[model samples]
Target: MKYQFDKDFLWGVATASYQIEGAYDQDGRIPSIWDTFSKTPGNTYMGHNGDEACDHYNKFKEDIALLKKLGIKAYRFSISWPRIFKDGKYKLNEKGLKFYKDLVEELKKNDIKPIATLYHWDLPQILQDEGGWSNPEIIKYFVHYASVMFNALGDDVEQWITFNETSVFLYLGYLYGIHAPGIKNLDLTLKAIHNVHLAHGETVKLFKNSNYKNQIGITLNLSPNYPYSVEEKDIIAAKTNDAFWNRMFLDPILKGSYPEEILNNPFGNTLKEIIKDDDMEIISHPIDFLGINYYSRSVIKHDENETFKYKSIPQDGEKTSMGWEVYPDGLRVLLNYIKENYGNIPLYITENGAAYEDKLENGKIHDIDRINYLKRHFISAKKAIDEGVNLKGYYVWSFMDNYEWAEGYVKRFGLTYIDYETKQRILKDSAKWYSQVIKNNFIEE
Candidate 1:
């Protein structure tokens, strides 16, 4: 069966500032937590940092040209905080702001809608030194930075995402010690999660009052949790894991509340200290839409020793180079679940694509695997739309391969293959496939 998305569906590609924009220490931009972490002794793969990644900071014009050629109608990108606040938290570096302004203008000139992400895990080093997102005061700082962006670039942007994957940054940073400002502590992680909710609420309130408003929302990387077995223990564990990862983030924003289990769990005492009474009302501020970043789903099994009493069960199937299982049907199931749970709120597949071990061949990349992966997912998206899910748009994981973080530059997720040494781009077979999808508003098989 062939299907076409609604003509108004948003078709675009996304990239983060730290992942692509090199020139890390130039134009008065100081070190972000990522910059410091990548340079540390044993954080990322091969000691590879994003110092000269994709060189997108300098090559943005060429990149914009790529987007234009792809025929995508939208481009989603993040702004680096250190670039704008070079001196301190409040300092406004015009050069840093101008870079993004110029990017926005160029995007508009090319007929692309600009969707701006306020924070994509690039916290200014100064803020991390001052306790980062763990401190309640950090909420104020985030709101201030958001205000600055709103006043400067908000008018040019049609959509604004306050934070990209709050769960990944907080969970990975606080419990895993893999990401920046590394701190692997359970209590601190709990506290940080609450503060993050507060920061989200505060920022949404600011956007509501701001005059420049087209569409505003948050992007979450969600994995549907299914039980490893039909056993009671596994089912309970799966639900608990869902509550922690999905409900923990969504309930606060959509329902204006948190799961009672999270508040009353073994970590109850720790959560109480940081959680405030008036926080839910603030966090629950209504928004225009929700952005979902889906990659893979997980099968949960009960494990008493694990912190959450749950663990992921490995399965036999096609997996990404990142080792995540590729399950396209999960996309439709998840889309329907969100709508059933959150009431008809507008939704966008903000990020959905896979990373593969790709290499150049003769002037182009024959990435048929990526094309197949996206075809299945796009089919699943059409199913959701047919079932009446209000899926507004779809944006691929990335436009081009750049820094992969933690794994560093080793993994490739871009539809466009990048020649790292020469900073050249080759449109992979997946890119050509995606171009047709955008050009026709339908996935052509």
Candidate 2:
């Protein structure tokens, strides 16, 4: 077996508040968009709501114990906006603040570095009602909330991610109506998208001025666009899609401007009008690092009549339980692509894991498929590192199975399988395998 990766390479697991922290109405917490969306009939799978997902809010100590056992170096989790800002009001909830204050202490006691995400799709319902990410004023609310967290937990948490998967949440929530605060309107979605980046800029500025010696960055779920064929039409489609999805978010932060190709489009032009003076300058503020969540590549073909002027061609290969193609080499390609295009900066595989129909037999989950998925991705990451990609760390998508958004609890994407009935976490086979990878500081291949 060959080994790769620097000795200090980070190994960790990530979880979001809405997905794992059930206790929807406990201890001064208010409802988030997720709570409202999941509870509404026909919004989620089997009417599944995250009312009692993993109960991590009440079981933080036990969860930290699991991280210590796994030998993980870091733990990436999000701060629930609603938890701190009940009903999206300006007032901060002391109990909500206490919960995270205690969680940070527990993580530090276990010698685990904490990566805190300010927003992870759990928007305060009050904010959503007032146009949420769509409203430019929402920046003020986000900045205020971020400031509170920075002052409260900044000393303990050195790494902070402003937003998680900006495109996914906005597209799903505003355009597709599949996620929280569901609303289907392409025009509104476009405005919301641009403003989301603005919010990111505001948060970045807030973190930098906090006077805490900390590293701040934003996490974008980047999808590499590949042409479906050698035809000129396909090639053009791929480029345009790349600008639409990848560049729209990346270019703004790194380059401080939107791609001309994206801004010139009829829809993209609409996004242009929303860009106010000094907005790009604010968004372009230099940050400490960039976290990318890569799942798979998109193979696109030109479509004159279709929205976004491109259509996805079905990928042919082994697919995950989420129907994402199992393409480990794509991870290496994407990592190199980011380094080549975005310049060498510290980058972390903030979220990477696949959903699978896992089963528990004899008090264990024999998820060999998941183990293979992670092993291949790990090797792919190492290949990029060997080629001079400044890849710092990789955090598996989830620590345990919990509410999986629209799919509810059906899709299991965790190394540790959670028995929903008893809230008992059974470490899957992948977890055991990952423990060794962490201990070795490299993937054995």
lDDT of each: 0.89, 0.88
Kindly list the per-residue Cα lDDT of model 2 for residues 161-223, writing each as its tens digit: 999998889888998899988999888898888787887888888777766797999899987
RMSD of 2: 1.1
**Lowest-lDDT window of 10 residues in candidate 2?**
83-92
- Which residue pairs clash in candidate 2? none
Candidate 1 lDDT over 1-445, as tens digits, reads 6788889999899999999999998889989999899999889898899899999999898999999998989999998988998654788899999999999999999999999999999898888888888877888888898989888887789899998998899989987888987899888888788888888888888888875658789999888889999999999998998888898899989998778878879776787776678988998888889999999898999999987888999889799999999999999999998989998899989999999988787898888889999999998998998998998888998999989988989899999888899998889999988998888887654
Clashing pairs in 1: none
